[model samples]
Target: MNFVSTRGNVSKIGFIDTVLMGLANDGGLLIPEKVPQIPAERLQAMSELSYQELAYEIFSYYVDGEIPDNELKELIEKSYATFRHPEVTPVQKVKDNLYLLELFHGPTFAFKDIALQFLGNLYSYVSKKTGETIHILGATSGDTGASAIEGVRGKEGIRICILHPHGKVSKVQELQMTTIHDPNVLNLAIKGTFDDGQRIIKELFADVEFKNKYHLRAINSINFVRILAQTVYYFYAYFQVAKETNTKTVNFSVPTGNFGDIFAGYLAKKMGLPVGKLIVATNENNILEDFIKDGVYKPGEFKSTYSPSMDIQVASNFERYLYYLLGENSEAVTDLMNQFKSEGKIVVNEEQLLQVKKDFAAHGVLGEECLQTIKKYYSETTYLLDPHTACGVAAYEECNEANDFCITLATAHPAKFNESIERCDINQTYPIEISQLFDKPQYLEVVEADNDEIVRKLEKLFSFSTR
Candidate 1:
């Protein structure tokens, strides 16, 4: 259960420390020192268990009793209690050989809630054990901010600061993060792209003294716990399909910007889920799509698309995948990332590129294609998809070469993107949780990308909020 930095320099650590020390000191993503493998029969045995049970079984491979079993179970129960659906994430057949795994059943109505809720509870446990407060710093394009806020809002011994790209997210997405009045939740609408905000967080974390002084932690998928929580759903979706349809193999199409969601699917495949293809779906900001399809990792202008959440040119979690793709050679990953940072691009060797293509297929859907997918799917199956989910569906339809059935991860509720839904001549009645967000007064600060100014503001805000 020990974890190591992807750069191969940092010392090995356990799960809890990895969770706390987000980005590795060596400027690499943390990955399990040894990825636990399961046999197909063992994975199938997990099908009969409930989501909570499945999660417990999967986490056992990572936690290794870091948190006592009973306490972990309690946290899991508390985290999932807020989900509106009996199945935290339900799988529905949208068409023949095409399914949608609905993941927006939690309080924040985004896939992130599943992980953030667990993380929030975990933080409470950690704070009590160490008798120290933690400051959570994260950059979100859309859903992560709201979900992370909801996770730690009003919780004791923790203060969360979320940075989001101002005016780049959907109205509901922005409102979800901005309207929260929790004194412990500090929302910053940065006057830059999500990549800028993300870069700021990484820069701050890379500063050893500054990171230690503030006890900075992460809620992004960069945190291994978030990725672990997300892995459960892939198993859940696979088992759910196995139970009813008896499908042996399934392909997952995940609309991802940060690479966390699909990376979870990749983990499931590595852990021996009969995953045929892990489809990396993207909007106009298709750095991931281009990189996976080709061997070149190049940065481009961050395009604001209908799917604002996917409007990211840089995918942070890609490093973790590179750890696996490069034969677990951390030095190679470190060199590649350093090159990408300095040159704004990195080209992989043919062998490395071939390895990437074997496990994952990537495609980018344009804004118009996303909108049309939403309208077309609604017309055919009466299934309303958010722009992000629409991109997933469109990618699957356009680039699917697998013979197995497809399961597109519906990352968010359509109600969260009402304007995009309306573009398809549809009106959505949001749930009471979302509808009430409009009535709440927003409390967010605007800041530039300067690290010192942002840190100063955080210090001032922390003092004010704590007092």
Candidate 2:
């Protein structure tokens, strides 16, 4: 299937080209020219397949001409083999009509691993085949940095530089990225919010000469491969829920900041996954919650919260959603995005707002509520939740219908946020695997959040002489 830019400025491109191009040159995201639909029988057939099998089935439609079926299936199997759980992403019953989808089974103990692992393998295959090297630049709030670094570390023909807000992520999150000593991995702690790092990356991509000179690529959700890999778990969770309850409809509550994870669920619904409602759970940075509920897309200042992963004001994946929300009207999507970028706000029309509300319900949880959720769940079921997953649980409890069968995504292992869980005296025991991470020495560079400074640092890291 061919892909096209959401802004209608770029010509039609294939999947591999889209992967390499990342953000479209016209300052827009790329989406498939046509969303493939699965037949009812095929959807039913997926319930009996393994996660790897199901991934191959779903991805076949998108990578038809680019990747062969056998090669893609092998890559998928190898990618998921890194996860500790045989199911890759497992489902646990929290209560009647309420379940917790455990997505931290991979090496990094976060949902981002599910996608980053696949992207790592896919990039290796593509780059090796074409005899090209890719220099990946990415921005993260917390989890994405560690996961992306782990995915591409020590790989030949690829180098990655990840930027994150300094003093914002948890101790473990920071160490997870900084402690990795691979020659190809460079970690930067910028003295600003996640948006600052994201803006710098986007600006670099927009510069034709700079991007071409460095052969830069991306590992952020703006890369369609990340979104495509994430779409698998949504289907996997739904399959398990459907098989157990003998029901077709299931709802998912995703604690999202960049909106990539829930956007994957939205894509699953488009492919006939029987998704009832997508609960867009957020922290104090509630721009996504407000936009989904009211169509008022105003981004305010970023706040530092216990759930640092959700501490974001600008949701990049929202642009891809708006492309579909506006009836695939590329011109309308471009106009609205241009307004948002220029004015810091934009509102959708009534019809578009109605369409958004039909598929999404949103709720924002506070820091106190997040802690309380961990305490409450531990008291009742001896289950400990990280700050981010607690937001999903609180959102599910507050907004879900009484009879709605809901699955809240457990995005990270609680051990990753030992300080937050310990603050409440949760008295939880962590796995030894996580306990050992603190012993590793960290190597990271700290820089002020300035575009020119970042460019100079990157040039120095890559051995490129300044002009």
Candidate 3:
């Protein structure tokens, strides 16, 4: 199936082009012309497949013969082999009706690894086939930068630059990106919030000439492929949990920041997966939660909570969801987005707001409540949640019905956020993977919020610009 630009200013493009183009030239996100629907029987049959197997099934509909089935299968296989768990994303029964989808089994110990691994391999595959060089540009609150770096590091014909908010992310998270000594990876600590880095990245992509000249691509959820790869775990987790609980529908509690993760769940629900409700769990930065609960979409002051990743003023992926919520009226979507940009807010009508409530439920968890959730689960059970996942658990506790089978997406390993763990005063030890990070020499350029320095850096460091 061809992908179409959400803004309606660009023609329908193939999956390969969509993957490479990333942010559409029209300054809109790419979405499928039509989200493929799976028959109940077929979807049930897919339930028995492994994580990689299920991914191939879901992805084939979007890959749509542009890549051969065998080649696609190989790509899926190679990508997931990096995961340490037998079930790449394992479903653990934390209690009777509550389950945790462990997504930190891959490299970087965060949920982003699941998609970045595939995207990195896909980039290499495409580059070798077409003899094209690429430079992947993205902004990260915490985990995404390291995951994306691990994905494309040292690969021929591919270079990646990641900009993160300086001193805003956790110590471990900062070291994860800054300590990576790969020649092709450039890590910048922008002197601002994650939103600042994100805005600069988007500004760079909006420059069509510069985007082409540098062969810039996105490794963020703004890339349709990342969202596509993420959907598989929801399906896999559903199948495993449903079979164990003998339940047909299972709700997912996702710790959301950029709206990309929950949007994947929305895509799954739209594709006819028996997804009950996508719980949009937020930290103190509750722009998404507020908008979902009410129709008011406005950015508030950025809060540097324990969950720094969720501290975003403007979610880059929210526009894609806006496109669908407006029923694919590209003109209206464009108009509303422009208004949100110019006015810093967008309010929906009562009718539209009701339709939104039907799609997902939202709740915001405070910083102290999040830590308490972490402490409660760790003390009561064996599972230790990271700060972000604690937000999901907190929201689930506050918003879940007694009978609903809920799966909280464990977005990161607890080791990544020692700040929260320490605050909770819990007895826990980090893995060697985490403790060893302290010994490595850190490296990153601290830059102002402007794009000029970034542009100059990319130009100067086009060839192994490690500095």
Candidate 4:
């Protein structure tokens, strides 16, 4: 499966090249030229396979020719071996017709681990094979910075610099990223919001000369590999829910920030998975919710809520979805994106809005409402939710009218956001792995959100010379 840019200017490239090259050279996110379809027989056959097996099956479509079959299988197996759970991502029945797809069993205790672990190893594998030094850079809200750091901490020849919003993320989230002292990892808490960091990351990547000089690669969901890796769980979760309930279809409620996770679900649906309506759950920063519920996509003032991760006005991955929404016409995608950048919003036509509404549902949950959902779930089902997942749970409850069971992605462990949990009068026994994080000395540099200032810091921080 060859990949092309959403802007449609870049030449077609294979999977390995796509993995190594994060953002497209033409300043657009990468997408497969074609999405592979899975027939019903294949879906039934896949349900019986283990998580790793399912991953290999789903990943093989895009990843077939570049990486050898045996090597890819081994790589996927090695990545999941770090997870604490036997099932890398398991499902918990919270109540009848409602479930939590637990996705926090990895090294850093967040869903980002599912993709980063594999991406990190893939980088190392490629670096070893090609004898090239690989430098990675990206911005994160909370969980992604830590998970990306955890993915490549002491791995040789792979250096990553992560930019996060200073003082905006939860304390545990901050500690998770800032405490890592690996020379290969540089954590910068930028003096702005997640949207600022995201913008900075995109701006830096847009400079083709600078990007090529540094051999820069993105670790963000803008990296199509991460989004592709993320789609496996949607298939796995759908298979599990369908088999258990004897239903033909199942819905997923994903708490979204940059629209990455839910976009993965959208890909799964396109790939012929019986994925019912994908609920795009958001916190106070609800640009995605607004876009889905209404035809207009406008960025409001960014609000920091209980779920800091979703405190993003600009959803970077939204551009990829827009490509498909515009009939995969790269010219139209380019035009709309240019308009969005210049005017700060994009509105869809009635037919385009109708098409999107067919595959997705969206809602914005409030801080107090999130807290109440956490309280209610913990009090009733004894299942604790991080603020992000609480937002998903609330949305799932609000949007569901189907008979089939719905799975809400439990994106991060509850312990990662104790500040939100505390407001619900809930006391959580911190995981032994997590409790040790507070004891570590943090290593981070505070920086302004300016792209040039970051470029200077990154040049100084990186140990290797440019290729």
Candidate 5:
């Protein structure tokens, strides 16, 4: 299948090219030329299939003929074997109508591992097939860095460098990225917010010459493969619920920051999965909520909240959604995004606004509400949740009163955000290694929010390594 850029300027490309070129050259996200549909029979049979078998079934369509079926199946099996849970992503009923899709049962204790692990395996399979090396760069607010590091570390013919805001992530999150002293891994604590780090990575990708010279790839959700891997769980969750409870329409409430997680649900719906509602949950950085409600996109200052992963003002994946909403009118998306960049706002027509609200609902909770959700759930149901999951739980309560089954994504393990959990009066502590991560020496570089500064640092790093 071919992929097209959201901005409409870049030429349509194949899946492997789209995977390698994280961000489109026109400063837009890449989406499939067409959303492939899954037959009803396959969806019905998905409940009996293993996680790897299901993943191979879903992803093979997107991979086209690039990777053979046997190799792809092996990659899927090996990637998910790293997950701590045999089911890969299990569902737990938190309320009568609400269930928590526990997604942190992976090596890195975050939802990102569900996809990054598989993407790492796919990278290995592709590299072996093509006889090439890959350098992966990613920007993370918290979990993505650690998860990507865990997935890509020690893999031959692969090098990964992650950029995260220095003080934004929790100690355990920071330590998870830094403690892995793998020769193939490099961690940089960017002296800015996650947005700054993300911007730098985008700028680096825009430099086609630099990108090719270093064989740069991205581990971020911008990679279609990352989203493809994530899509498997949505189908898996739906079928699991269908088999256990015999339910048809399952609603998903995702605690979202960058929009990638919920977008996966949209892709599932596009593929004819029996998904009911795609609830978009947010923290204090609720730009997504505002945009979905009003159809006007405006990014504000990043808020430091209990759910640091959701502390994003501008979501990178929103552009891809805009492409679909605009009926794949790349020129229109380009114009709107440019207007947003310059004027800090862009308004959609009433029809477009109606279209968005019809399929999606959004709500944001304060930090206090997140903590209270954790405390209330723990006291009332004896179920523990991290701050991010708390946001999703609270949002779910606000939007949906009763449904056959509503699944809120548990984004991170409670151990990663011990401070937030304890502040809610829970008497829990993280691992000893987590407690000691604050004392480890960190290596990073401070830079201004300029494309030139990012380019210079990347060039210096590349030159020094080669010499």
Candidate 6:
């Protein structure tokens, strides 16, 4: 299972290399050379398997040569055991055919836990095998920071630094990252938007000397392991729906910002999972919607909406989709990406535009729509949803109604956004654990958007630690 860079310039790499190098040297995300297929018998038989069992069966192909069979099984089991739910990811039927897939039942109460937890385990295993220490750097809009921190905190032979835009995420989300005062953990409140933070991470990766000096790895969606771990729930949800109903194809409406979650669904379809349309639900920052509907890909101002996690203009994972749309023409895709970065937009050619429309259906919902969905769900079904889940629910209505069985991803627990949830008149309270996080003092550095400044901070931290 070799991984190839989306930019097409870098040499093909083994699974471990792909995992370690989140983005290729050519500035592209790594994708599998081929998306392995799951046999029909296996898909049918999956209905009887447990969540961990299903995960092992589905993900084995991707990590086959990298990790031995027994070790892989152990990793999967241990990774999921930490989750709050035994089922790992459970689905609820809010109405006749509208289902809510609960993915926030992990330590961080966000969908990122599904991937970040497993990724943390995978990182530990690989680091031990190679006898190397790794420094993980990630940029998060909201949930990914807390989830990544939960995954890597207190782990040996690893250091994690997460960057979030200053004043972008909610107070709870900020505390979730900053309250963890482990020496292995570092948090940065970047004086810019999420895009600026992401750009800094990318620049760090591009600097070979800095990356190697710090043993820089990534927990971002750019890492193939994160995507592989995320793909498990799609299959789990599919089988659960199939077992309960006679539905052949299940449509998934994902409230997306970085596009990683829905891209996992795209990987599942390529792997022969009977998934229908992959609906992309966006908040006020609706760059994806515009890209799918028309051929224009543009970046706009980052609006601080109710769903802070989806307040992103540049979807990093979109590069992989462009790789597929261009028939794996990495050169062309790279050129387009460079142009898009320089000009802030790019108009796709007709052929590429046709492919996007074929597989994607996108819709944008405002904060009011999110509130309305939360209110309506509470009134009709008594199902309380966070702002992110409400965004998915609102966008699901704009997509096809013919697909009766639709799974809307509940990305985060309402407690993570208690203020926003309260604004909707939902009257939700935080968990005891979450409520306690507020009292912890936040420890973080505020840095400008200069690469030298970030490097200087890292140097000072490392020098102080060594002394």
Candidate 4 local lDDT, 1-467, one digit each (tens): 88999999875799988887788888888999999999989889999999999999999999866889899999999999999999899988889899899999999899999999999999888988987888999899998999998888888878899999999998889999988887788889999999899989988898989888888888999999889899999988887888788988889999998999999999999999988889999998988888897878999998989998889999889999999999999999999989988998899999999988997898899999999999999889888899999999999989988565799999999998998998899888999988998899999999999988999988976756433
Q: Taking the tens digit of each residue's C-alpha lDDT, what string does model 2 give over 1-467? A: 88999999886798899999999989899989998998888888888999999889888888975887789988899899999999999999988898999999999899999999999888888878988777889999999999998888888778889999999999989988999997788899999999999999999999978887887888999999888988898989988988899877999999999999999999989987889999999999999999988889998878998899999999989999999988899999999988887898989889988888998999999889999999998889888889999999999998899987999999999988988998789766767777787889999999998889888877766663211
Give the clash count for model 6: 0
**Candidate 2 residue runs with Cα over 4 Å from true position:** 464-467
* lDDT, candidate 6, 15-134, per-residue tens: 888888887877889999888987888788877889899888877787765788899889888888998888999999898788889999999899999999888988888878877887
lDDT of 5 at 253: 88
For all predicted structures, in order, the TM-scores are: 0.98, 0.98, 0.98, 0.98, 0.95, 0.97
CA lDDT, candidate 2, residue 449: 86
Question: Which parts of model 4 are misplaced by more than 4 Å?
Answer: 463-467
Report lDDT (Cα) of residue 360, candidate 4.
86
Instruction: Show model 6 residue runs off by greater than 4 Å.
Output: 463-467
Best by lDDT: 4
Instruction: Give per-residue lDDT, candidate 2, residue 429.
Output: 72
Q: Cα lDDT of model 5 overall? A: 0.84
Q: Tens digit of lDDT per residue, candidate 5, span 298-349?
A: 8877889999998898788888788889998988998998898789887999
Q: Residue pairs in steric clash, candidate 2?
A: none
- When summed lDDT is taken over every stretch of 10 residues in candidate 1, the lowest stretch is 458-467
Worst 10 residues of 6 by lDDT: 458-467
TM-score, cand. 2 vs. native: 0.98
Give the per-residue lDDT digits (tens) of candidate 3, residues 1-467. 87888899876799999998899999999999998989999988998898888999999999989999999999999999999998999988888789999999988899999999999999999988988888899999999998999898988888888999999999988988888897788898999999989888888999999999878888988899999999898899999988888898999999989998999998998898899888989988899989989988999999999888788878888888899899999999999989988998999999999988988889988989998898889889968999999999988887778899999999999889888898999757877888889999998999898899899888876755322
